[model samples]
Target chain A: MKEKPVLRVTSKLLIPPIMLFALYVQFHGDFGPGGGFQAGVIFASAFILYALIFGVDVARRIVPAWVSRAGLSIGVLLYAGTGVAALFGGGNFLDYSVLAHDALHGQHLGINVIEFGVGTTVAAAMVTIFFTFASQSPHDPEDLRDEDDDADFDDDFDDDLDDLIASRTMSQGLSQAGGAGGREAR
Target chain B: MELAVVIGMLFFMAAIALAIIWVRNLFAVTMLMGIYSLTAAALYVALDAVDVAFTEAAVGAGISTVLMLATLSLTKAEEKPFRSIQHPVSLAVVLVTGGVLIYGTLDMPAYGDPDAPIHQHVAPRYVQDSGQEVGPPNIVTSILASYRGYDTMGEVTVIFTAAAGVLMLIGRGRSGPGRRRKTWDYEDLEGDER
Candidate 1:
């Protein structure tokens, strides 16, 4: 089977401008038609399109699954950390005004930090979802083999073989069949 | 100020809306929906709500359509062939709701009225003091991040929750590796013949 091409040269060409636009939105939210959340999603979507065109394995190599999970956790932590910092500063949760001794600049700094955090988490979560789905096995081999074997076997032996294959496949297919051994392998 | 532009925009919006309702193909409907969002964003710009227009453009034209397309991939393209008779009672309910909305709009201020209640209320505070209060050049950012910061936080939490839910529902569950192993075993059987 011909594998569908995921990232075309044209798509690669398209990503730069879109990413630049996302940056424009992120930094220029003070002036223009974009903000952190929107820019983050757009940025993530560009990668997502790349993954869709390319295989998930390639995408995973670019942004690995463990890294994506860490990205998500870090993004949330960065956001909540800012909030915690404010709390330590004797302000309410996420009170930007208290972030610095100079109240005015503190709010600006706080908003920027939080938005960045939100953007990161959103992007990472999106890629993670794509990876999770892409990683799922769409076919079962044992079932196929047993079906094939049944076709070759004689009627007398066929029923016995079928029952044995069915039970074995069932036990293997269910994840909890051998608890400790399976967990260790994983 | 031109009569032609206003008429054209209205006609375009109507045409797009009609297309959305009329298209039987889900893919076509999704494309039309993107067009509808873009046009609506344009309309928001024309109405001078640049901030709202920006958001509508990004969320509606960008993210929503991507999500819709992603969802479409997991399901069949066509609607099921079953048809239900249009009930008069349901039609009446829709008409009544629309009528009420129209009736409410009739009493409201005309488009872009400076003296409107909306302009006189919390908006003026946001416009005037946002730069001074929040120290951000953009009033929309200040409002979204500071004035209504709690709501923004809530929105983020909601998205996080949704992402978690999707991850849980679809991520590497217990059976996945076993399924892969079963496939590998079958492939081994095929290889044995060679």
Candidate 2:
């Protein structure tokens, strides 16, 4: 893929605009049709396109795994934290009107912050999933061997714990668990 | 004009579905599915559901198609030959389900009917007063981001969880302490071989 000059040039030309459009969708969502979810996916699509053309490894180096993992957590925290901020403002949970001196201003501010959070999480999640899938061997034999090794025992355990807690809260409860279970079986 | 576009896209989608059913090549089926999603996205735009259209275009036509292609690279390109296509029980089930669905649509309101039950519900308040309440001109955004913030947050979390699960299952450990090494990087092993 990296050897193709035409593809490299064309993708290089297209990627920037695709990314710009994604940002437009993310920020202008309040006045336009798109919001975080759409924006995030669009943003990920740009990276996916890059990966397709240049290579997944190259793209991963630019974004990296930990950066994606952090983005995932940060986005959720930003959204939930906004709600908590509302609570501290002497309003009910997720009530944005009390965030500022002016109700409309508070609503606007809260919506922007939350939408940003949503966009970040959605984009990171897509990238992480893509990287995970793309990185796997087509004929996987390491599944058994990898499970047995435990050198960074504390780090792996903590990472697994973080992912589990995040997933539990984020999941739609019963249905998501069932889907995750099915994936695990595979 | 919108009706004409909708009808054309519906026919196009049906043709794509029929082609998908007839195609034995799994690769072709995946491509046809992407086309189907693109058509559906266009149909959503014609129906004035731009938000939904945007999502379908990005997710259905873009990411999912790429994912399916990635999955295909890991599996056989040809679908397995079915032992038999005709089963009386399966046919009966399909016919019954389709009939039930069509019958259910018969009781629904016409497209964009102001008096529809859904329109009569809390939709009116959201449409009329959301400007004052949530302060966003886009009613959809206001409803999603403010009026129903919790649901959106939960949806985000669901996506987050799904990605985490995928990473846990198939993702190589990050290259650091306790890292599990790959037998070979796809680039190094498969690139030159191909």
Q: Find the candidate with the highest lDDT and give its number.
A: 2
lDDT of 1 by residue, A103-125 (tens): 88899788888888777787777
Q: What is the lDDT of residue B165 in candidate 2?
A: 86
- What range of 10 consecutive residues in model 1 chain B has the weakest lDDT sum? B181-190
lDDT of 1 at B148: 79
Local distance difference test, each candidate: 0.65, 0.76
Model 2 stretches with alpha carbons more than 4 Å out: A140-186, B174-181, B184-194
True-structure RMSD for candidate 2: 11.6
Best by TM-score: 2
lDDT of 2 by residue, B127-153 (tens): 899988888899999999999999999
Candidate 1 Cα errors over 4 Å, as ranges: A1-7, A129-186, B2-7, B173-194
